[model samples]
Target: MKNHFKIYISFLILFGLTSCSKLLEEVPKSQVNKDQFYQNEAQCIAGLNGCYDNLTDIFTHNLFKINEGSSDLAFWALDDADASFAISPANPGVGDIIWTAAYHGVMVCNATIVGINKSPVAEGRKKSLVAEAVTLRALYYYVLTSMFGDVPFYTKEVANFDDLEEITKLGRMPASDTRNYLIKDLAEYAPALPQIKTSLIVGNRVSASLAYILIAKMAMWEKKYDVALPALQKIMGIYGSLQSYKLVDILFRNKNIEESILEVQFAWSATGIRKTTLVAAITTPPRTANTSIYDGVEILELGDKANPSTSITPSDHLIDIFNKYPNDIREKIVMARDYNDKWFNRPSRDNFEGKPWMGPKFWAIQMDNKLDGNNQKVFRYADALLMAAECYNEIGNEAEALRYINMTKIRANIPILEVYPGKQSFFEELMDERGRELMGEYGRKWDLVRWGIFYDSINNTIATENEKIKANLRPYHEFYPIPDEEVFRSKGVLTNDAYKQ
Candidate 1:
């Protein structure tokens, strides 16, 4: 129980502060109520825990469906709306879940920040606590503006009925403006946080390392390489040696490894107190027997629940790229053609169907009740290194860029490139490298969108069997539509103009 005590508190905070209805419309029903909470350091810290709790909600099964399953790395084998690019404002598929959760996170972070400021905690302690909340708020906003452009942005806590009314009338803020605000805000407050490894405490807490990475990521989205380079360099100074991290075959198998800068913490509990993740259940092919190639691996009939007709699988396009570089160690780690001693779409190993399931990197060895305690890696030092390489390449320093890219290539035991392609070509290779290294971890869709090639990328998959993706994808789909419920609640303040025909 001692091991799960923090998990329990985070779960409590998750249910207490977040609402599925209109954002900030309901009064919290948990032990920590905003009306009479945060009187001391303990209460302030609890409030901040609520802010961290929201991260679990944001990086959920739905996010996986939209972010990775819809991208080139993986695909929904079934005719899922998101997989087929059939998402819309009215029928948002999983977009509504992601949209609602991100905004709820922002609201919880805002309330926590305000409560911490008003609390009587020591000045130094208060500053650090508030920095955590602010950093978390920036993350929520980043997800918001990334997924749904021009979201209804707000920083004020909805403390009273009047404040709630004002929130209802708020209009959508430009995504650029929101990113700029968060970049500047994090720059000022993130330094106040002590330099601690986020791998501590199961990688659930915010630290300066994660903060700088977030700053660099958002800046990269806006093409502000100058701002991004320094932020990435800050992380490089701390973790550049690459001695502590590795290209481990199965990353999430051990939670909070040194490679992880941030992870969405999950735990297994019989009572199901928001302690488990649906990742393995959704990603792997469903099975009922224990015929796994590895000893003591238990298979479950859980993978097809999210899409009952079919399971999520690695795309042929991804496999083709992996085959392009046979020496790439990540190929077997990221995908497998056999499961339960039987090849995918085949009765047994002797029969050959080339379909591949998501590899052991994502499987939960002994998943319980169709769920597992796999902590989702939200940020890792490997990605930071790649981003550093990208920033350097963008800033016309090809030598520095190759140095960082080679770090990953060497770790994977793959041959490193000595010749630098020109800037544009180098970026294209970086894109594929990111897909190769970070496939299952969220960011594929966002990467395509950031590179202005989402529509083209999805269309390219049509040469294989992604006809639905090509037919349904639109230019404006670079940004997902806002949930209709949110627009309705905003009473026209939040218009889905980009999605309008």
Candidate 2:
């Protein structure tokens, strides 16, 4: 299914039916034109495929910088803007990349929704397809508000070049309002979406399970646990027993395993047509194609497709957390100071400044050059369980919280969190448990922000290596500033007041 979707996406791009990145700044009108397209079911499917295009790009380097790099789990290996927490509105690092990608995604999704609605497809199919576009648009807004706080929110499509004027004039809306709107939108679409277990379908497309998870996630960001808890339990009920899920070497090693809820699909093709990315290259240690030996150890090569850009690496705090639990099974899969029973002493900052390489969870064993085809796991059942535990703890259901948290711990073969003196203590431990379980994945920074501990957590970070982050991090640095170019382009309609100089 992933390969099938990738091929369809490639075809859409070739036909100019897919939206490009410039849609963020310019009109979303493609060369094929929406008027001529979406006349049938196949065309509507192609339009939906375009919406998934940017999702593949979202988890790449800069967003990784915003999501995990700025957080305690990892940091930019160099003195990059985000690593030093000196990302001004002027400089385009994390903010520009994520902002552009997310807005482009939103625009494409809006176009898809509008096109699908008017298409000649059958009623039921049109509803389901539009439901997907709505969910995907919600996802883009989710990224926007999560990273930028409030952004210019609009659901209407840019029907023509003239609409660009109205689009630019739009001002930032409250993140909470955007989130609440999306929560309701997803609810309306939930019934139209299929109830198939995402794992059974390998999470190739949006299902009710994915929609619920997104709803829960966005609701939690607003601290609306009353809205979030039921959505999470909906997933728990859908997926069924924790016994069916386990912590294994399945993350990137085996894409779209049974534990997966949604994965951004990627496929490697000898013809270079398959949708692939350099995520594995960015995450893995820098190495050459073949015969890459270092310090008497054969540094396992991540193939010759992409240059291993060691942009992001694990922080000392994350390393210590894994070390704190030597008996834990996840350490071998998550990170390693050594590989193949030998120290990965690569003499470059790309390889964690010769510290540790991200473990098998990210390594693309069959990568062709820099084109690692591993599907980036966006949402997994394990994450759903952890989120449920957080929601339960927030609602004062300690017993249920412990039950959910223990599911992962029990799978990891670590000690179960059997007891806690109070809700805060349990919540704190659950935070660490989430860290240990989902170390290199995205949303760690968002976790700190939503928990209202972003400032304290980074300031209290004991890692001497990240002192620069602590020094430069201000209270207002929680959400990145809207890019100066974007603010300027909006003709003062948009402002990053928190970053006004």
Candidate 3:
């Protein structure tokens, strides 16, 4: 009973307390119950863990679907909601999924902050807990604004049903306001977080290094290279070098590695608080019951035959890039051509043939074949290096930019260029480098969007392959539609005019 209660409390924070309707219906009683339930440091920490669990939910599904699927890196086998840009206020697929999940995470963080402030824990412990909550809240908002453009932002915990009316009436905050608020929150609380966690189990928790990475990313989005450089330098000062290329494969299998700034942890267990990640199931190609061959090559057993659903596949452009730079070590680790061939030969029943490349970064040989224990990486040290190179280049420090970019290329076992010729050429190289390095890691769409090239990039890469995709994409498609439920609930105060149907 005690063990069950512990699990219940640790995981229950985000359930039933998500939507505005539920907020009005259940928050008063839920808060009253939790007020009595949470009083000590252990309980407070458990609540904080609950907040982190929402991140797992966010990245495990829709967030990746929207971020990576919509990018030139990938496309869906079927008519996926966000991938096709078919989202509307009426049918807000990724928008609804991510919007609900992110705000639920924010709500949990807000509750934790309010509760922890009133707790009897030591001041130092209290400070750390609050710092983590604040940092996480900032991240939730960052994702929200990044995806949905403008979002309903709030800091207060909904402790009672009475708060519902005011909350539902709130309009979408401007994107600049949202970014500034997040920057302020992160800057204030980042120093309070520890530089490194004491143990691996708690490694996924917020740290000063992770906070700086988020800050740098947000600054880069605003084209404030000056603000981003210091944060990138802070990360380099803390963790001096990138994890070696030889260990790149091992980096995904293991947790709390030097390369991983933050990752959502999953345990391979039949019954546990943390089960397996969905990446394995979603990314892995379906195997055949009988062994098959294509062009004298045996088909790779990428995943289980019984569980056959490869919803997302790598783009042909991605494969061409890898082929163009065959020496790049990331190609072997990030994708498998054999798996793609297998899928191509034995196409799915829906006539969805696989692309030339498939993501294999999170593939695990599951013993039970139920779920995979692979962790979903959020921020990586390589990303820091790439961002650093961009910042340096923007600041006209071509020498410094090459220095950082070369570190990544050297680690990839690729030859480094001696000169970049000009800034435009260098920027193009950086774009390709980012695509090669960060493909299938869920940052591609936003990366292109931030660079103001999403539309052109998509049309240029995919128009020849699928004219329908080129026709579907619009300038406003860069920002997803606000969810219909949210707009209806807000009584037109919150609306995405571009997606109105």
Candidate 4:
């Protein structure tokens, strides 16, 4: 069956109907019906390109919104008054789009690898491409697992309905299991990925440090400090240094020239990415402002046009978490209230008349907001060291933990505060730094979930805000409720219902 598989065997490879596999692998990328499309090197690369599109979609689409929001920074921010306690099933199918897009990415990676193997290209180049695909697919699963826990773990694209059902119902692998899968994938692929020039920004599309970030996340979840150490050690030794802090850059716009690890690709475009522009993820400098742009603010507005893609703002609790940063970078990160021209440009200059400006970690746009401006970073070195610090703390290596913590601080030019600052627990201090540094970059909710602080924070926010409806903000929200739609197809095998809410 493996030898007989041919992605280019048919003419309808575009429909994602079948896969090409060697050695009877169960998951290839989305079933690319073997067709003429798989016959050439260009076709193989195109398929890989499509897979890369899935990653951008995740950030620009639904998961990035909810996953970040419901975690710590926000309540659902829904127009519906009933959303305060959004029950098991929520949303009107946007999550479905995310689900489709995520699997679609995985499928592309699977198919690309299979097609590469079948190609006539040299094995070395082919292997390099294969490494990138695996690293990307692994990252895709990491996102999928973060959003909808226990996603079907398909490594090869299944062309047959039987195989689809079998794989789909395979149930949620323990979170640990899915994490291990990605960890292994990154470890295998990271070395093969090239050392990318920061400005050039695209290589085989994955880097060694990026892999360490993923492994650091996996180890953090598994509480495997030792297992996670070598990866961070690799990162620290090679690519994990933090960019020196510039006060103006740190306060007004947050981007670490040095710390960035993985970044979703974006080109400066006048028109803008429909997803990012609407969601406020993209920013421009003043000279290049584009007004017709429906900036994320217009999209995030409450009345009728709230964006489905906005990177939700930090909650009051998140604001309080950084209360210690009175003059520190985090307070200046975003406007406590709406701010206009005089302040937006020099936000670090002790401002007033504030509205919700983008958080400091993310640079707000230029005079006229457009998508072509700021770049979104996926992995940064500070996160790696912080992750290492967490693992070190858990393993009771206080010295190692302090080293990583101080390293991130020294880069930010933050004062070298104790890991256990007076009255602040070590874990509390760590969580605070995570909020202050990574705030809106997409890891807050995960940190809250892993730290088991959602209930305390969300409930407190609701009480503080006098929010109309009350949500349990339970552990289930920690991992989005696996879409009810996926559950229906699982034949009772894969269900979020089984996990005690």
Best by lDDT: 2
lDDT of 2 by residue, 406-494 (tens): 99888888888767558988887788888888775677888888899887777766234676676677878788898888878788998
lDDT of 3 by residue, 38-144 (tens): 58888888778767756766776467666776678777656666667666778777677778778878877887788889898899878888988888888888888
- Ranking 1 against 3 by lDDT, winner: 1
Provide the overall lDDT of each model, using Cα atoms, as 2-decimal numbers. 0.74, 0.75, 0.71, 0.57
- Residue 158 displacement in candidate 2 (angstroms): 0.6
Which pairs clash (backbone N, Cα, C closer than 3 Å) in model 2? 304-369, 305-369, 305-370, 306-369, 306-370
lDDT of 4 by residue, 287-374 (tens): 2122322332232112231222333445666667666655564455443332332333322334632224444344434312323224
Write out the backbone clash pairs for model 1. none
Number of backbone-clashing residue pairs for each candidate, in the order shown: 0, 5, 0, 32
Off by over 4 Å in 2: 1-32, 286-290, 294-296, 299-307, 345-355, 366-370
lDDT digits (tens) for residues 1-501 of candidate 1: 122223322222233443435333333433244546788987777667767665777786678877888787777756777777888889888777777677667877887788889888888889888999899899898888889878778898755446667877888888899999999999988888867667664335788887898899899999999999888888777665765566773356678776777788887755766576677777665554434322123334323222212457677778777776789988767886654554555323455545666776776656664677788877888899999889899889989999988888888877786999899988877887888888878888888888888877877763256667767788787787877877776777878786788
Instruction: For model 3, give the RMSD to the true fold.
Output: 4.5
Candidate 2 lDDT (Cα, whole model)?
A: 0.75
* TM-score: model 3 vs. ground truth: 0.87
For model 2, give the 10-residue run with minimal summed lDDT: 1-10
TM-score versus the correct structure, for each prediction: 0.88, 0.87, 0.87, 0.77
User: What are the RMSD figures for all models against the true structure?
Assistant: 5.0, 5.1, 4.5, 7.0
